[model samples]
Target chain A: MAQQHLEPTDPTAGAPPKLSTAVEQGGPPTGDALAGYLRAQATEFLRALRLHRETGTASSVEESVDAARALRRSARRISGSLHTFRPLLDADWSEEMRPELAWLSGTLGLEHACEARLDRLLLALHRLSGSTPFPAQSLTSDSAGSGPPAPVTPERGNLTVGAAKAGALLERQLTLARTRAHSTALQALGSSRFHAVADKVAVLASEVPLTPAAPTTDLRALAAAAEDRLLAAAAALPLVTAGHPYNAEALVHGLSPDPAPHPQDGPWHQVRLLLRLHRYAREVLYGGGAPVDVRLLAAGQALNRHRDASEAAAAAASAARTPRIAPATAYALGVLHADQRHEVEAARFAFQQAWQKQTVGTP
Target chain B: MAQQHLEPTDPTAGAPPKLSTAVEQGGPPTGDALAGYLRAQATEFLRALRLHRETGTASSVEESVDAARALRRSARRISGSLHTFRPLLDADWSEEMRPELAWLSGTLGLEHACEARLDRLLLALHRLSGSTPFPAQSLTSDSAGSGPPAPVTPERGNLTVGAAKAGALLERQLTLARTRAHSTALQALGSSRFHAVADKVAVLASEVPLTPAAPTTDLRALAAAAEDRLLAAAAALPLVTAGHPYNAEALVHGLSPDPAPHPQDGPWHQVRLLLRLHRYAREVLYGGGAPVDVRLLAAGQALNRHRDASEAAAAAASAARTPRIAPATAYALGVLHADQRHEVEAARFAFQQAWQKQTVGTP
Candidate 1:
């Protein structure tokens, strides 16, 4: 029922003569629909790519952030669509394009990630430094209405010199690092690998690689297969236990010696990706005509969160290792490290719980 | 230089000699030393367990948190030591016990994560609900000292009815979930699974199953080998890229064709664990006489952060999926999810940067 509710519903069902309605309703995906979808995504990708090239070098950070975000989204849409509809397209061509698309996305994501970290760390440090230990007013207030106010707990100068120094170190290093990454991304974009991919995609709008007179294919099977693969992968993963979930040896010990080998944590992350594609496929094909699976959407969304948290914690650890810095700075870094690590743990626990619920009773 | 600095340094080089120092100066691991280390960890593990049993059921949440923290730490130490010193024990027995420990840790971690999420979500909502759109003072007043003050940006009421309902739903569900998990953990601690583990560990402290006349082995070599395995595994992992890093197919494509294959994300995490064990081994064998690999420590520490972030993001996502709730609450949940996801991205970027630096010129 949850899955059905989440499926795309055709709000315009049985509407009088609309071009979009004819292709989307009560039928498998035809070559025309696949081609149309690919073209739209390709066009959007190029548009974003061009905008990025134009504004990526701008002095304004916000501009670059916006450009990068747009580029990533469009690129993702193009890539996802290509994979989902590949059965109807030239397999070799689709395969060739996937890697290039991936490289572009990775390059952009790297810079954006750095910029985001810098902003987060800086904001946190600023708040920490700005906070004062005690209020200016005396503890013994003579206000009639307010009963002897609870003892104003003094803010014990929480921001140590080490903390401030650590904050400064983070700012300096993260800023430099982000700038470097951004430039690297820009360079990559300008490289032949990127240009070749871009040029290919630019031409794809007018000429999609659909097979000649391809029959309509039921996308539901593809989507189900994707889901099944993800489920199987998850089942094989060493289930999270009470001890250190990150401990590899313990996980290795738990691995089933079945022919279908259980993958490591990395592949599990891949499962998250497949889950997303499956959800997107459902959305694109069903397009409000069919009910979506909420559980799948939820699972995909949760996996995204898991991946994000895992990466962030790694970044924070890097930040913590600012090196040869003052004791104050080191202390601050430690605090940051601890905070980030806690967040990582929280995310893992949440995923396990969510995944367990999602998989229950689904043979 | 930071890595070098983090390496272990001998503290008592010129100090008076102790009986323990005789066996630790550059030789293979002796059975007695292995026995001693295992015993110490077992003692710590049991002590923590008793404390947990005593305090876990307390009315005060803080007490339970503290006890759980202690139990987790001791359990981790025991588990780590076992993995590092497995050769000194019966292989089958060590393998059998590892899973039970993992189960215990995972259970406790679940409760802790839920509690943390509930606290975080509630605090965020409080802050959001507390903020007003505008200042109370007259905007027309032109104070001489203040002089052309920058206009204050209005805080648009971002909290919709859907957001509030979502927050409440999260609070209620997360709170209930945490309580249920806490009780479950407590129950588990008293369960047969737990008792069996405890009884096994108790027997382990007194009698270690070391190989007959096992020659003293160079622990450094063992540690290095461990690190190498981790690195190899990391190398095999399809490097997390921008495009479809979440996609399972892309990741699988990156898998090596060799029989002794390395995993991607999973191996990187394993590297963190091996690094920790190596550091601990150094601490135990050298007794502050040998310096630690600062780079290794830093790398491990960063990995820990990565793991934490990954887990936390998953938790935040679970929180966001407060189903069948108010639309306003749903909106709030969405906002929370986005913010947390951004944090996750930031962390991943940081880790990549750190890892690149940490692994320069080393295959």
Candidate 2:
């Protein structure tokens, strides 16, 4: 199919409805306006997806990371905009496109994570293995439920042995994983599933399906509902509860049996995504004129920290559990895991602090 | 109170109850054995904690990361063992120590994550800004939901300008956050909350509370129940269901809304914690005898990927929204966000594949 281009029209260009359009003969031309915005996003998404495919084969890490990042951002925008503007678009088309976009972006996201992790673990190893006075007093002072603190000698040789082993174990495993992820990403890019999405997007760049009755769609109401849905979800999180420690166990046990831990258990994680969508919807509507909600932004940022810290801790724990590693390496990894866990606590603390400080209301 | 040391006796040295023990003159010596094990873990935790304290003031990132990791691992072991053997120990004591251990580990976890993130975003900037062919065709071929792919020229100037801006924004914000976290951690270490726990642990090194009825505590039953609880929790995960993608939205929306999304919302995140507890239980019971469950291990690893990818995507998105940055930087951040989100997608895909391939049973 011949690829067509949509003009990069401003998404917020259409004037706000003069009144509740329910009384209008057929409502204002908001459907076309929404479609115009959707098309612009679709166009940008296709452009970035194309960039990803082109650079997917590159051997250079930098090239792949950049390209993948572009593709992911575009996919999110398209998906978020589709959901936000779904009322004005063909229901079938929106449903079909959302999952496919999700699939494509997810593929790229994994590859990027592998690359970043490899980078992080390796750098940690380098720093760890470097000659520095091993802080002998650290373990003793910070020791918790163990026996009395072991004496730390100011010897680099003793400390480096364990740290190096841990580093080596992590490097081997992460490198292997990164290679696998890189290959998977390449294969997915070449797959028919990907190609099919590309074809659809290329078509969407020019032609967007609009319901005949869409002009009458109340965007303000839709926006309000979306915001309300997000707020409702966020409010429902265990983090919003009094006396909660923002840990997994507390959240899980807090639920009533049945579906207790699966769906409701993830309020902290789920809220971030909702916040993303919420922020995007506001951006689409408010454009440059309105200031973004500080609370929403802060909550998202704090949650982002929470997620990052927790994931890092998990990763560190995984490394520490590597079977049959040298004792020294095991020791090093133990330290790494504890450090990452501390970060998780800090992030949670930060989130709690923010939540407590903020007035309970919409941003 | 003067600190005392519990003898590190074999936890299993005390025989399993010779009889139902209800009629025994005095309960068997099981409480002492259990306390012995608890003391061992406590000692290890304190040792690591000391190492962390000693190294906390180190300017070397590597030293701090390593020390923090050790503190975290020891804390986890202590926390896990405490829960596993809570029936044999003082309930109030165990309850109090678990949260405090959690706090200490959490503090270190946050510090490590901030340091890691700052390192990652800065490195990404450096690479993105470096001169290369730019792998310009990436988006064109991968373009999915938009219009015709934009052409990429090999020109380095256009891409680098925007990338550098994005990189700068991330560097500045992440550095600030890292600095703040470091200070917070330091403050926490010196706070009464931390010192109080330390003093308690120091005292516990020598003495432990045993419930009067503890001698007859059935450990084997406790282990079985703990395992069952973990299995039940794991089974509750949406991943256990066939054809579930690992996205937060799908999982949330999958629920019919009666039970809501709380239970199903957190499989990818919540399951990891349960798995950690289960693994620890096994390690405690089996020691070096039984091999780790390969399926459980693999699931844990896959879930780790899902988490890392998703978190990275969120971080990227946050970066993309950097306020008052140059347009070029914003463009770069857009690419980075897209890339991270794609990684998230890829990890979820990998997880679904793994879950499907595994036999339907507790790993």
| Weakest 10 consecutive residues of candidate 1 chain A by summed lDDT | A250-259
Q: What digit string (tens of lDDT, one per residue) describes model 1 on residues B1-363?
A: 122312225444442233134144434445455565566666667777777667655647677677778777656766775677677667888898888888888888888787676666544444333332122122221111121233422112212232344455555667788889978987898799889998987886677666664335434455455556666755554345411111212112110111111122355566566666666565445433444445555656666655554444444344433323222233334334323333333333444445556652211
Query: Which portion of correct inter-chain contacts appears in model 2?
Result: 0.00
Docking class of 2: incorrect
lDDT (Cα, tens digit) per residue for candidate 1, span A132-185: 322212322111212232332212222233334445555566678788887888
- DockQ values, each candidate: 0.01, 0.01
Per-residue alpha-carbon lDDT of candidate 2 for residues B1-363, written as tens digits (9 for 90 to 100): 100111113334342232112112223224544555556556665776777767666657677677668767767876886887787778988899999988888886776676566555544444433324233223221112121222432132333434444455566566677788788878887899988987887776677676887655644456566767766775665443323221323221110112121222356677667667766654444331224356667777866755654454445445433333332333344334333433344454555565556553221
For candidate 2, write residues A97-158 as lDDT tens digits.
Answer: 99998988887787667656655544544443433423332322111112222243323233
TM-score of chain B of 2: 0.70
Ten contiguous residues with the weakest lDDT in model 2 chain B: B252-261
Residue B79 of model 1, lDDT score: 72
